[model samples]
Target: MRRGENLRSEDYMLIDPFINGVAEFHDRHRDMRLDVDNMSYEELLALEERMGNVSTGLSEETIMKSMQQRKYFSIAEESPSSLEPCCICREEYVTGDDIGTLDCGHDFHTNCIKQWLTQKNLCPICKMTGLGT
Candidate 1:
């Protein structure tokens, strides 16, 4: 707050959170260890999957299975309207383009939505949980 001011933990975090986050991230990753010499191939794959789920939010299969995909169709045929681009990538959707439509009705390109789901289990636009939906 001032020159030679005492910093509480909260204050230090507020002032220098990036450095603290780096240290915390390093500490967290450093703790995940593998006994490669002893583990079998299957064990290694399982460990990798576990680590993947930890590093990312969900597995690809889970995302693919839980999220619904449909061919993009224009709503303009029903009424006057404009097309909106995919929220994540801001790319305009063409008819028949594979779209990931969440239960909340938010539409995104399939790849964009998959990438988003890999890191987060909720809808980017509505914050609805994928599993719940």
Candidate 2:
């Protein structure tokens, strides 16, 4: 994604309601595995791996802690020669604006980046994950 790139509907990870219900049922019955009968071991493993990705997303607490680890400061306190407008909001940054920077070295308005991270766990600029790590 670019500074002003438009994302398609498919670009956003829309949670599937049926998947959520299945995941919840699985959580309630931890010992039960998906009934993938008569399949090869490798096919079963592949399905299990893909299900893991679909079922798990970063928790809110995890997201908050990761945001805390990011660098945040006022533009006046840590003055820079130049700054880009926040890609999420597309407004030029001014002094006294609260900015947050990621480990990927991209900066945006603190609120803007926080909102972005709440839905996705990667840098809006570089598409890098593991911000908490």
Candidate 3:
């Protein structure tokens, strides 16, 4: 129905999002390696299903299955050590806050930058760069 979608079958529909989400997940984990290669095909399938659910908030699993699916994992957990408040709102990033980080390693809450990106894509505080950059 969409640009990259087909109405041929249900499995095809699932495949597209699965592959796309896996691609995103791979980009998000390029530097990390999981025990994926070691997992049985059934286990891998289960993990992929869980990943799909996690990405879209369809399921209520607090932690993702991939956490246990990988080895030598390097996921980006919320940084507790960097307690610095967002440069825009001057508010701390809470447990469920969405965040975006700059190439310069500066971080900001998602809402602030999203509003700013709508106007233009640059950091509100430093002005070094923005979403478009």
Model 3: how far is 46 from its true place, Å? 64
Return the lDDT, model 2, position 32.
70
Clashes of each: 0, 0, 5
lDDT of 1 by residue, 5-98 (tens): 8889888787777873543544565557666999999998988887674553678888788878889776656542366678899878877889
lDDT tens per residue, model 3, 25-75:
437666675688789999999988877842212111221211121112223
Clashing residue pairs in candidate 2 (N, C-alpha, C atoms within 3 angstroms): none
Taking every candidate in turn, the Cα RMSD to the unseen true structure, in Å, is 13.0, 22.0, 22.9
Error of 3 at 53 (Å): 42
> Best candidate, TM-score-wise?
1
Q: How close to the true structure is residue 44 of candidate 1, measured as C-alpha lDDT?
A: 89
Candidate 3 structure, TM-score to reference: 0.34
Per-candidate TM vs. native? Answer: 0.51, 0.44, 0.34
Predicted structure 1: lDDT: 0.77
Clashing pairs in 3: 34-70, 34-71, 35-71, 121-130, 122-130
Off by over 4 Å in 2: 1-60, 68-82
Error of 3 at 76 (Å): 16
Which window of ten consecutive residues has the lowest lDDT sum in model 1?
20-29
Task: For candidate 1, give the lDDT of residue 95.
Answer: 70
